[model samples]
Target: MNYWLVKSEPFKYSWDDFVNQGVGTWDGVRNYQARNNLTAMKLDDLVLFYHSNEGMEVVGIAKVVKEAYPDPTIEDPRWVVVDLTAVEKLPKAVTLKSIKSDERLQDVSLIRQSRLSVQQLKKEEFDVIISKAYEN
Candidate 1:
């Protein structure tokens, strides 16, 4: 399965909001590259939920429950969204500071393209972040 990172400002959509909703649709992507990443997602693909702006950390894991479909929140046909369900909250948040400081994640898309809200992650990078979250 593909690994991905998706970001949202906690004030706009927090992990608690996601879990409370039970199922969430990933939408509002207007950027070409981020839109492509959304389309690339497949059912059951794992995703890291990052709190951008306020927290700047990976807070939870989610899984794609449905493939890409036209976004319901907008009238624009060019945009699409995927249904995701919260899998689990991380034992601890994996902060941007930690990720940037780690040599293993230096080449990750997250670091290289900080402005991209949705980005692909290599399997190793995904594992490393998970490890970091669980680290004491």
Candidate 2:
């Protein structure tokens, strides 16, 4: 399955919020690239839940429960959303600073396109990050 990293400001939608919601639609993406990433997601795909502004770390994992559909929260019909259910919390958070400093992740899209809210992650990169989270 494809892997991805999706960012949300902890203040707005914390990891706790997602966990408590049980399952929720990941929407409100206005950027073309980020919206496209949501559209491309398939059921059961794994996603890294990253807290963008505050923690700047990947705090949990989630699985796509439903495929993309038109976002209900969007005024524009072009945008889409995906349903994701919390899978598990990371044993330890993987911070952005540590990821950027790691040689193995230098070429990751996250580092290259830091401003992108939703971005694809290579399988190897996904595995590495999850492993590192446990190691930490």
TM agreement with the true structure for every prediction: 0.98, 0.97
12 in model 1: Cα distance from truth in Å?
A: 0.5
Candidate 1: tens digits of C-alpha lDDT, residues 1-136: 9999999999999999999999999989999999999999999999999999999999999999999999999998999999999999999999999999999999988799999998999999999999998888
- Name the regions of candidate 1 deviating beyond 4 angstroms: none
For each candidate in turn, give its C-alpha RMSD to the true structure in angstroms: 0.7, 0.9
Tens-place lDDT per residue, model 2, 1-136, is 9999999999999999999999988988889999899999999999999999898999999999999999998578899999999999999999999899899999887799988998999999999899989892
- Highest lDDT, which number? 1
Candidate 2: misplaced stretches above 4 Å? none
For this target, which candidate reaches the highest TM-score against the unseen true structure? 1
**How close to the true structure is residue 25 of candidate 1, measured as C-alpha lDDT?**
90
* Superposition TM-score, candidate 1 onto the true structure: 0.98
